[model samples]
Target: MELDEAIEKRRSIRGYTKDPVPKELIKELMEAARKAPSATNRQSWRFLIVQDDDMKNRLQEGITQHFVANAPLIIVCCLDRHAFTRQLIEKRVEELIDANVMSREVANMLYQRKLPQKVEETGIPVSAYLDLGIAVEHIVLKATSLGLGSCWVRMFDQERVSEILSLPLEITPVVLLPVGYPAENPSMRPRISMEEIILGFI
Candidate 1:
């Protein structure tokens, strides 16, 4: 499907059909996430599929939105805790320079920029969260392209959900995705005019 069509058609579906989403289709949707780009190629996002009935009920315990439990599958997106460490980014820079992926001058310029520190001052999980966002979007869009419906949900208890999943020490669950066949076709919502949103794009 065309990217434009997918973007337009994709919506937060609160209702879902009882039709079971095949494992093969789920794998295809996740392939998009696996191929998503990450900072310095760290691939810090871990995708967990939760389909067992007992576990799904456990996930919905802390969440108020009961519709989430209706989804045929839930994608638990976890971000690695150390994705923004200076050492790992520096190693990537060295690799890029040595492998001729980028010019040494460019790499040195990046190293001297200290972008991560600036982001840290603002308390943003920059590299890692940004990467996680891309992966989550990929999953949703891919689901849309393949005639599946998905919703990006965050209205859940992070601690409880993480504990239920038995996530590792450094892996943090950032978003929940519920994927299944849509029970309703929601019309596209409004968007700001380009004139208002675009700020002097070159």
Candidate 2:
């Protein structure tokens, strides 16, 4: 499907069919997410795909949205807090410089700026959250293009989900994405006018 069509058709699908999503399509979705850009090229996002019935039931306990368990697959989108450490950020910047994607002078300037010295000191930054959101949106759009349905679910217990999935301390779950064949076709949700959204074009 065309990108524009996919964007227009995409919706927060709350209902899904019993049929399972194909593995190949799932891989495509993951590939799209993998290619998403991140701040300073810190590809820090991680995804945990859950399909088992038992595990889905367990996950539903943490998620307030019960419809999430109905989907054939659940993607536990996460952020690797350790990736924000000065060491890792410097490494990524070096790679960018080597690839000529970023100038050495710019990289040096970035290094001079204050950043988290250790992983332990790295709290989840807002940019990291935005990065993960971009990746998740990639997945959602890919799903729509592939004739699948998905929803971005955040109304859930993050700590409980981490415990249920046995996630490492560094891997923090940020969003839950449920994917499958659509059982309901929802109309487009209301949006603010373009004029309202575009405050001023400088």
Candidate 3:
């Protein structure tokens, strides 16, 4: 499908058909997401595709979001804190030096003293969350191209999701995507005009 058509047609769907999404389709979606660019190319994102009824129910129980439990497939997007932190540290190091916050000599000494601690801080998951957001956009667009319906939901309980999924200490869950065939056909919703969206070009 053309990118414009896919973008125009894609909508956040709440209702879904009873038919299950095939595993191969899920694989293709992830493959497309794998190609999305990341900040400093950190690629610190991972996904847990959940189809188990019990697990989905458990997640839904903790989350107040109404639509999350109804879909046939729920994908949990996770951020790898370690990877994002490494990228952030590398990106910021030169900036610190360039700004003259530290001399090269002092920077080198500070790097040796603080780099590890900085890396540790990066594993907090916000970086991974950014990575996951990009990946999720890729997945949603790909799904639209494939005539599948998906909704990016942010209404789940973080602690419950983390415990239910047994997510590692360094990883954080960002968003949940419920995937299936649409049960309702929705007309295009209103959107801001391009003139209203864009600013002066300078």
Candidate 4:
């Protein structure tokens, strides 16, 4: 499907059919996420594909929005601090080389050398969470193309989700994505006009 068509057709479907989403289809959606551009190609996002009933319920407990647990699949998007640190280091090194301050070999060495120390210091920044938004959008667009449905949700408790998923240290939950066969046929929500949104340089 054309990108614009996918964007227009995609909707936040809260109601879903009980029909199970094929594992392969879910894999394909995630594959699209894996290809999304990340900051410095750090690819800091990690996903937890949650389908089990009990676990899904547990993770949804702290979420004020009850529809999140109703879907057949919930993709928990997490950001890896270590990965973001590596990305920052690589990006900084590249900027230095591009500015003619460091040779190619020197830049590569510097990226590798400083990564571990940065990881020890700051781990990762909240800005890396933006990468998860990009990845989730890719998955959502792909899902729409394949006649699947999803909703990007944010009304959940972070600490509760961390406990429910048993996420490792330094992996922070960023967003929740519910995917399945949609039951509702919601009309497209109103959007701001391009003229209202875009600012001219003049």
By TM-score, the better pick of 1 and 3 is: 1
| Rank list by lDDT | 2, 4, 1, 3
lDDT of 1 by residue, 1-202 (tens): 9999999899988889989899899889889998998766667788889888898888888677998877888888888655555665677678877887878888778778654533233223677788889989999999999999989899888888888788866677888898999999989778889899889967
The per-model lDDT (C-alpha) reads: 0.82, 0.94, 0.80, 0.82
Show how many residue pairs clash in every candidate, following the order shown: 0, 0, 1, 0
The Cα error of candidate 1 at residue 125, in Å, is: 3.1
Q: Give the TM-score of candidate 1.
A: 0.83
Q: Output the number of the TM-score-best candidate.
A: 2
Cα lDDT of model 3 by residue, 1-202, tens digit: 9999999999998899989998889999999889987754557778899999888888877678767788999988887666645445555556766776646786466446433344456435355566678899999999988889999888878888899889887777888899999998898878899999899698
The RMSD of every model to the true structure, in order and in angstroms, is 3.8, 1.2, 5.6, 4.1
Flag regions of model 3 displaced more than 4 Å.
85-114, 117-120, 123-128
Residue 134's lDDT in candidate 3: 86
Residue pairs in clash, model 3: 81-123
Ranking by TM-score: 2, 4, 1, 3
Residue 189 lDDT (model 1): 74
Q: What's the residue-level lDDT of 45 in candidate 3? A: 77
Better of 3 and 4 by lDDT: 4
Write one digit per residue (lDDT tens) for candidate 2, span 12-124.
99999999998999999999999999999999999999999999999988999899988999999999988999999999999999899999889989989888987778898
C-alpha TM-scores of all predictions: 0.83, 0.96, 0.81, 0.84
lDDT of model 3, residue 136:
97
